[model samples]
Target: MHQLEADALTSPRAPSFIVTLYGDIVAPRGGVLWIGTLIECCAAHGLSEGLVRTAVSRLVSSGRLEGERIGRKSYYRLTDMAEEEFEAAARVLYAPPPQPTGWLVTLSEAETVSTDWLPIGPKAFIAPRRNDVLRPNAAVLSCDTVAGIGALRDFAAQAWPLAEVGAKYDAFLSVFEPILAHVWEAGAPPGPEALALRLQLVHAYRHAALVDPRLPEAALPEGWPGGRARALFVRGYLALTHAADQHIGLTFHDSRGRLATATAATELREDRLRRECLA
Candidate 1:
């Protein structure tokens, strides 16, 4: 078996893998899935029924999921709080490559900084500009590059864990590159395998991409693997969607009936990813 397939079968925890399922599949199909369906899906990743139940219960308690029962069968969907969080994550995972905005530099008297802000030095942090970020007790300044792209790259390497993030991208490429090659040479795997592969692809890429500071290309090291990884993710995901959707249509269920195989929202998401890959 391929290393990527082995990793998919062995590496995921019940809770995070279930989150991946909801984010990638269940959410787009109306955000609810029957417990039996959830268990069958999780079993592909070697998660036991009991483990899935415990994880679902924990997710409900933690405000990430809510459960309902119809007579004897149970179903779960994301909570409002979890939906908001998932939406944020989906933007990172599905949106096109971010354009290079100038930096937001913060000067604070506090010793520590929010995880969103990268520590450049003592009492100072920097991040990509976003309107929503709170810079409490800090003088925030928007910076435009006057000169020295090299200097900015060096500073970014130090401030953000670029090397570590690069390693993650490298690992992602190692796993998915082979799968993409196989898909191109042959075809997508069978429906069940396709669904499992698609979920694993999202889970692995999300792990690497979310932690990325997403610095401007000029500010990043030469030949960064992030762009390559993003392209592969888009291509591989789009390639598998047909078979995976077939699996979902046949196997996924909720209280009302079988979940949608594709919705308008899911189609838009595919279009966006296709545009990104082409661009």
Candidate 2:
């Protein structure tokens, strides 16, 4: 295995990696994958066939996947519930860096805030005002500037685990920066390798980006790594998509045979990422 691939597959676990594979690759390509294809892909990550089977069974039991048998073959796809979750995640993973739209502060003395909202004080919480995020029902206020910039940043640091999140972003950069360099020098990798690297890139970035509170620039600590990480992800993913999609078309399968290389959904995502890269 390439050192980069080895680094990407560190502490590989079957279930979450499979979810990453499905969300990044299969979900966009009709959301169904044959078990054989699943096993083959997981094998590249050092997961055994038995482990992959067990993981798939667990995902089905947990309602994240639903399985179908066509002849002697088994195929799995994300359940509707899982699809909704993955769709929300996809928006974050693939979309461009969001513009600062201020913050939504919600106050509710009677009800508890959702995990999505960071609790800033008793009965008060805050979250970035993005279109994808549902607004919480409470006494809500939109604030572009909460206080002095330094104080607001301090308050943000106190409310969210910015240090920990920054560490995650730093880790992502450490892993992917070299991979990006390799792509730049040697060009896109082979089909299967390209697919693996792309999945790992998304997996690593998602680990950091999803946990991020995604506060506005004024609210974030100076020298934040998140923007740099986002730029790297966008560039690397776009570089790999052509080769990676070729691998997906040739290798991945469902009851219906090979997966589509390009769909409206896939094209739209590529377009958005391309625009983001230019932006």
Candidate 3:
């Protein structure tokens, strides 16, 4: 019997954690470091004090992160070099490759189950569930086996305005298909290297796709896919969207009230299919 081992699947937290950490640093305003607020930010996201301290130290040494030590706290801000490196990373992500745009809809349905379903960050707990809090084990999954494809496809269409996003989304798919195919064929589990690639691709895709220009001075172009950076952002955005959907059975729309009703279950099948395949 063929078995799907846990290691073959991607490390669920790596991509999201890296991106989120970078985001926290970049978005700090009013003298607040969002990354410092929670223990989970460091622990669950694999941000050890040593790793972060070293990263900050190097950035400071290299002039990417600049800060003043006020009494005991070290507040870091991006230096010009840091901004360049950050934008450079973003640019590489959205860069277009020599590929066609037909694969987006196809790869949308690839599943990531059969891999370990590790939670991203600590599970959000509260007395009353917040509307924004993602449900437990509902938003994460592993593409360790073929079974994961069905779920992956379901996630893409939901997270992105597939119909609206159009060609750029398709272009994003073109790059992903080959990677997915390689993973499937190698039957190899993701070691550190493979996992790093997966994380890179996912983060780059999401930032491209979903970056809110509503954000003050969003560094990228208004609509992505117009430029190399945007394309990579969309690609990384989709990857993150797909990963989150797999890990948590997540949907931006409400899923709790109707899931129990028979009609809703029947409706869920059709709705789920829309999610799985772009067609």
Of the candidates shown, which would achieve the greatest lDDT relative to the real structure?
Answer: 2
Arranged by lDDT with the best first, the candidates are: 2, 1, 3
Summarize candidate 1's per-residue lDDT along 1-279 as a digit string, tens digits: 345467534558899999999999987778889999999999878899999999999999999999999999999988889888888888888874465577788887555456668766787878776554556566888987779999988988887889999999998998789777877787888898888889989998998998887876778899899989988999999999999998899889988999888998788888899888877
lDDT per residue, candidate 2, 144-201, as tens digits?
8856999988988887899999999999998889878978998998898888888888
The whole-model C-alpha lDDT of candidate 2 against the native structure comes to 0.86
Candidate 3's C-alpha runs over 4 A off are 1-20, 23-42, 70-72, 95-236, 239-279
* Residue lDDT tens for model 3, 126-224: 111112222243333222223444454444335334345445455555555455445456642323333334444544355444432111112212343
Top-TM-score candidate index: 2
Rank ordering of all candidates by TM-score, starting from the highest: 2, 1, 3
Global fold similarity of model 3 (TM-score): 0.31
* Residue-pair clashes per candidate: 0, 0, 37
lDDT of 3 at 1: 7
Which stretches of candidate 2 lie above 4 Å from their native place? Answer: 1-11, 109-114, 121-123, 137-139
TM-score of 1: 0.87
How do all models score by TM-score?
A: 0.87, 0.92, 0.31
